[model samples]
Target chain A: MSLTIAIPKGRLGTQAIEMLKSAGVGESIDEKSRKLVFKDENRNLNFILLKNSDVITYVENGIADMGISGKDMIMENSADIYERYKMNIGRCKMSVAGIKGKRVFNDDTIIKVATKFPETAKKYFNGKGQKIKIIKLNGSIELAPILGLSDVIVDIVETGNTLKANGLEVFEDMYNISAMIISNKISYKFKRKEIKEIIELIRKEDTE
Target chain B: MNFLNIEDEMKYFQKMFLLRKEIENYLYEEGYLNIEPSIFEGYDEFTGINSRINRKSTVKLLDNNSEILILAPDITTGIVNKFLPRWEYGKKLKIFYYGKTYKHNGIGIKENREMGVEIIGEKNQNTDQYILSTAKQIISRYSNDFLLEIGNSKFLKGIMQSCSFNKEEYDNVMNLLYSKNRQDLKDYLSNLPFKNAMSTLLNILDLEGTFDEIKEQVEGLYLNELMQQGVEELSKIDNYMKNITDKVTYDLSMVSELSYYDGIIFRGYIKGSNKEIIKGGRYDSFTEQYGYKIPAIGFTVELDELIKVLDKEEQR
Candidate 1:
């Protein structure tokens, strides 16, 4: 039987597909294909394309055997999956950003903050002895500060290009983000040897 | 087929009954007596019991006289409220129980079937060590590859108190540390005046090593008296347990389910499983609501989770 792997869609998806190719599982993921499942017959591996956030849930719930996701997503969701290996790619830093040249208050005013990651945002302000009014946004969190909708935003910064273009500067860095390989708790145990071999192959390619 | 069918349900009940008997017999052999109390309790008794179970999770009902009654969501609260008071006055009490606890919707099983033992009276390091060692022995008898992670909630409390953090700040720090978000911890610590002390404490929490290795690293640092005391107590427990089994380890950053726990807390796990199979800790102030003061520590095994772990292991 072939091993089933879940690759997160979006930016991390490309790197994951490349990693699989380097580990000798040839790419069969057609960029324009609407199908979620891709198969490489020679390597006997099945790849399922899924959202980055859903990767851990799919693995932990045993819908897929293994997957790749960010450590930030794993921590935020607190999904109970076995972290097999850190992929060391898709690197970024989660940070709090506010409009540049604006004075950031340290008082307990109900400062409105906007971000997709409400948990991270709430936690940052709460630690500073401030009660925040959290404004949940899906895209373009930078717009919150620009539009006066929020006093600050918490988002992932790769090159800080998006934030700088919107006149936002990093106030505090939350944590480093990277793609990590995870496996179903049960599958990791039962398929230990196969998973270990896959991890070794990926690590070898990573070093070279 | 639906496993809730009458025939399957009966079989399941029979298995659970047998398991309960096994647990009771084991506790009895260890000098614990079985205790049972009413299923319903006063609303005030459960106040601040388990942080995970807020008022929303409590199953509240009105009696004929319109008195507020709640289905016991936790056996510890029931024991402290009704049973422990009735036990002999000035003597140590070791009690074991198997019962069902109700919750509104989320948090734990809808009606949790739990088997646990509580040791009341006498607050000392030996009591902590005994309960931990006994738990390890009992759980290990069932499975060989389980890990018992021991942590001191008091240590975290001490650090928080020393830093003089308000409730909001304390909760934020706990959330970040529990999630292992080192960057959040660094950011939070940077804004505080006690950056050096906070960093040292955070570094200690980040250290994951053998018991002796952690103790050695801790010894080199300058910790407050309360923290030092916590470390010394943990070391004793670790040293005593090391001889019994290698499955035990220390986790300084463990976030307890109950906010009232004043001492050591532990969670037992079988490898490859993300959920804790067994959990408990010491709550010296838990009995204050019952109009008396007592020191106690206990743990309950989620038999369903345990059975699942065993089934997975057998399949492998």
Candidate 2:
């Protein structure tokens, strides 16, 4: 029985595939193919490429023994899978941003925020003892504040280029986000040796 | 697809009842007396056990005397409060219970049906094996790929005591291990006083394999008196369990807030289930709360999770 690893399809997908290749786990992943499934028979590993947001779902369902995705997705989905290794790739930050001159929040006023990550936004505000109404958006989070749909937008900022282009400045940086390896709880229990080997291999490669 | 319509729901209920009966039959054969505790208990009496865990329970106010009442979050506490004093010591009492335990998980009020066996007055390696084997029998009858992962909390407790970590540092380390964040664990250990023990602790944290494999790894490490005793007891129990089932493994990182579990703790998982289908261990310190010193061991099988797994398996 080969261990199945779920890889998210997006910017992080290529980097994750490269990491695995360097770790000597998945060597047969096609760089340009529409097929969702890839297999390495010699290493007894299966790779399943899914949407970035759906990677945790596969790992949580036990359909995949392991997954590699950004920490932003982990927090957004409230994933309960075991985080095995911090790959230190795809480094970014989740932050609150608004137009440069906007002061949409006051001492006794409620703030309207927009983001694709409603759960993460809710947690951040609740931790600060502030009340907020979250306007969930799928994409172009920077447009929320510009179009008056929200007072501030809570989203991931890699280099702040999009925020700057939209005349927005960061109000507060919430959490550090990065790519990590997560494992299904049951798989970690049953396939301890194999999983440990893969994690150690990745950790070794990371050090070099 | 509306495949889970009325007929499927009814079938699920029927299967749940049948599963409950199988557990009851096992308890009966083992001479366990069926006892039902109250669904509601006094807050003051229950708070001793409830406060230990960070979860909240549904509470109602008694305006008459200003005393608070809580939906019973614990069955063992109620049983001990009502029965342990009258029962003679050194005489083992096997009590079986089946009821709904209420808990508010911050999302909503949830009720779960739990059927468990509590053995009072004996806590030894043999007693642990007896309860575990009985649980193994019931779980094996349901799923063939079930795995039983056992651990001794004292393994980590011994290490913590030796290191003398402050409360904050202890909690940080435990949380890292609980979340299985290996990278953070490595970084945190590098700056801590117990940096030398990092490799050994990480090995034990990642230790999960066959009985012999785990034993070999643990044996190669330098252990304190308490850790050595924990390892010896686990090995003895492993010897006993291997005779009954081969789906057993060891994981030293497993810990529970059920502080009452003084010795061995174990959890069961099927191939596809996200949660443990069964959890049990030796809780010798629990009886002391009732003003009696009695050794006890027991386990509860969550029927809801079992049914869910069976349903998923059927779908496939």
Candidate 3:
């Protein structure tokens, strides 16, 4: 039996494949190939490259037994999956960014926010008893506050350079995010031994 | 188009119905009768009686009398409402039902076909053993890849007796455990003033393995009076189950969403699917709602999900 693991396409996917190689469960792929699905060099594991959001969907539905996804994405989507291991490959923070100094508090005024992650933003504000209006945008979230379309933006901040160049500073860092190896609830049990072994390999690779 | 779309379209449903009949037949052979539950229930009565069911999920409608009614969201509640109140002493009720339960899934109303077996009015450990054995046997009969995951609700309830939480906080902790969100659970436990209690709860959260193996693992953790009693209660259930099936796996963190479950709780799963094929447990607390102290345990086989696997097996 083989385990099918989903990795989001792009940087995280490349990094996850590298980690899998180090764990002796995978090898480097032909980056130029048009294929989205392929078998690992070990031939005992299958890898499926998917969209950032689709990774969790695949894993949650058991199309892919396991997948590597970001904690932020996991929370936003909130699919029922087991977060097996934390891979420190894509370290970042889900933060509230706006024009530098004015900190938005839970006052009477309704704060307008823009982001790709509206559910997460709503949850964050609701936790603080802050009532806010959401203006969801697909990309270029910084433009919302810059154009005065919104008071602030909620987004993932990797190194603060993008926010700096766009003349926005993080208002509050809400959550720490990194790539996590997550497994379907049923898959975690059916393939317990194999999943445990792979997690062990990841754990050992993390320490080294 | 096959036969210009005139061919019988019930092919798929025919297969599913056959699968349902096989399950119903197995239970009937084991001395359970088919119970066709009513489709409608009094709305306020259903909601007030079954405290755990989300009120928003019940599809409410106006009757000829203009009183609000709800589509039956569960079979067990209806069964108890009928039998438990008028039971004869020393007589055990062996019942099973294949029915549709209606519920709103946030988007729209959905109906599920499930087969259930119930044994009520018995107050012995033997009843629990029979139910667990029957559940295990049924799952094994369907799929060789099935796993019967078991846990005791009193185990968590006992551990929680020491922690005083308001209604909101209690519900939050339950949600965290239900999702198995270990990261947040750790954060929630970090609020504890006592280190010993925190560590023990975390150890319990991570408890996995055989019943015996888990018992040994939790031996070193701090166990107060209630926690000890919880362990002793589950010990008997484990004793009843271990010899009958080797497919059992113990998980202490498994919390059933239904508040009625007050004893042994379990979910059955097979490979190649995340959806549970079987969900049954002891809902004795629910039985107490009828002003009687009847002991009850039962489970439902979700025929739809089982049919999915069956379809795959046939294809292969």
Candidate 4:
């Protein structure tokens, strides 16, 4: 039986594919193909495309034996999956951004924040000893501060171009974001040798 | 949509009923008596006593004379409030309950559909091992590929006491560690004085290995006296558990969401599934809220999740 590996779709997917290829499992994935499932006949590796956030769910539920996802998604969801390795790709910073001159902390006023990640946002603000209203937005978080929808926006920043374009500024960097390789706890237990070999291959190739 | 028809629903309910019976039978054979209480109780019985019942989770209404009443959110609290007071003897009290627990939040609609045993009046580590061992036995009968991760609340409290951290810093570290965000935990602890010790402690917490490996790592730690005591308690329970089930794992950094658990906490999971199939821990303070100050520990397994895992395995 082949090992089913879930590669998160989007920017991380490209790097994931490269990492897998370097680990001698690349023949399974076709870069240009829109197919979700890719199989390597010789290596018996199955690559499944999944949304970045859903990658942990799939791997945790054992639908996929292994997965690659962002550290942010894992932290937010807090699934009990084994994080095998940090790929250090698609690097970004999850930060709290606000309009240029807004007061983030005012004793008399409550700060309203918007983000796709409400849990992360709430946790970050709560840690700062400030209670803020969390407004959940699916997209265009930059518009939240500009339109007065929120006082701050918590989102991933790669180049700060989107924030600058929307006339927002980075207020605080919560944590750094990077891709991670994770496996089902059971899979790691039962297939340690096989998984460890793959980890070694990827680590060696990445270093080289 | 037709798959959820009356027949399918009946079948699902029948399976659940049988599973409940199996659990009840197992508990009875192990000396647990069936205890059932009224579904309604005084609002203060829940709110003023045990704070675990969030006011929002309770379905509150006025009685005939406008006295506040609440539908019980959990049977354990009802038992503690009503039944335990009548027991004059200090004998081992093993009670099992199965019924609908009304919660306004309704978080466990399907998988969280609650049912199980609560063994009170026993404070020994042996009782803890027995409950865990019995649970493992029942679950193993259904599926063999399961892992029971155990931790101690005392360990977490000890770590906090050993370090000089305010509430915010404590919460942050605990949150980061609970979420298993290794890098964040490392970064946060890096500047601290006992960074290396904290790192090793976190590593030990994340260590998922055989019984010997866990024992070795735990024993190697340079823990403070309080933490060492916690470790010693864990080691005793782990040793006892090894006699019952080989699948038990010791995670030193594991913390519970509930603040009441002052001793040990545990979560059981199968080969897959993002959530714990079963979760329970020792909340010695549960009785303190009622002015009894008794030590207690028990667990409830979401039979629904177990069924789902089995169904998936069958399909596979």
Stretches of candidate 2 off by over 4 Å are A21-32, A41-44, A96-115, A121-138, A143-154, A167-173, A200-208, B1-10, B41-74, B84-88, B104-109, B162-170, B189-203, B219-224, B257-259, B308-316
- Indicate whether candidate 3 or candidate 4 has the larger lDDT: 3
Give lDDT: candidate 2, residue A26. 79
Regions more than 4 Å wrong, model 3 = A28-32, A41-43, A102-105, B1-8, B41-58, B62-69, B84-91
lDDT of model 4 at position B200: 53
Q: What docking grade applies to model 3?
A: medium
lDDT of each residue in B1-316, candidate 2, tens digit only: 1245899778777888898898898789888899887877787667666444544556455747878877766566667677777868578788888977777876776787788778888776678888888788878988999999888877776777776778778877877777677777777777887543455676766566776877778766767887777788888988898788888988787767555676788988887787888888877777776677788888888878888888888889
Q: After best superposition, candidate 2 residue A143: deviation in angstroms? A: 5.0
Q: What docking class should model 4 receive?
A: acceptable
RMSD of each: 6.8, 3.9, 3.1, 4.5
Better candidate number, 1 or 3, judged by TM-score = 3
lDDT by residue for model 1 (A114-194), tens: 888887667566667788888999998999999999898888899999989888899878877877777775555445557
Could you tell me which 10 consecutive residues in candidate 1 chain A have the lowest summed lDDT? Answer: A185-194
Cα misplacement distance, residue A166 of candidate 1 (Å): 15
Which structure is stronger by DockQ: 1 or 2? 2
DockQ of 2: 0.61
TM-score of every prediction relative to native: 0.70, 0.84, 0.90, 0.79
